[model samples]
Target: MLEQTGLKVSSRYIAQIKKKCGLDVGENFNLPKSKNARQPQCTPEKKEA
Candidate 1:
């Protein structure tokens, strides 16, 4: 439908929309790159002795 209406979904267009909507402009802005990407204190839970 988007292609038929000429309102397509492209990387450039998406980036522009994101910018207009005050969203992140950089790639992987909201996504995690790794398991401990944002976790500075990652640790495993301890079991009872």
Candidate 2:
């Protein structure tokens, strides 16, 4: 959109603007909500230990 307006604003500047306007800038809602979503795979030996 900035390209269309011929404006050369940095990503940091855009994030600041979005924050000031109270807009959802970088939030990702599609991620899993489960607590084990990012748990690493446990080996049988590690589990037994």
Candidate 3:
């Protein structure tokens, strides 16, 4: 599927797969850290009062 999308199976994306899908199975596999994901961060205080 990824190859069809012209996307190389890089380590970063592999980590994401391990995280979102919980499919880690290799020595070099690394799960994407939920807290440190490259997306935006919204702490409770920032989102509310």
Candidate achieving the largest TM-score = 2
Model 2 misplaced regions, further than 4 Å: 27-49
TM-score, every prediction: 0.36, 0.41, 0.30
Instruction: List the RMSD of every prediction in angstroms.
Output: 18.4, 17.3, 11.3
> What lDDT is obtained when candidate 3 is compared to the true structure?
0.49
Alpha carbon lDDT of residue 13, candidate 1?
55
Q: After superposition, how far is residue 39 of candidate 1 from its true place, in Å?
A: 38
Better-scoring candidate (lDDT), 1 or 2: 2
Please give, for residues 1-49, the per-residue lDDT of candidate 2 as tens digits: 3556545555545655667568888965576788677633433342232
Ranking by TM-score: 2, 1, 3
Best-fitting candidate, measured by lDDT?
A: 2
Cα error of candidate 3 at position 10, Å: 0.8
Deviating ranges (above 4 Å) for candidate 3: 1-7, 24-49
Candidate 1 lDDT tens digits, 2-43:
655544345655565567569888865566768766523211
Q: What lDDT score belongs to each candidate, Candidate 1 first?
A: 0.49, 0.55, 0.49
lDDT of 3 by residue, 1-49 (tens): 2556544355545444556567764664555768667753333342232
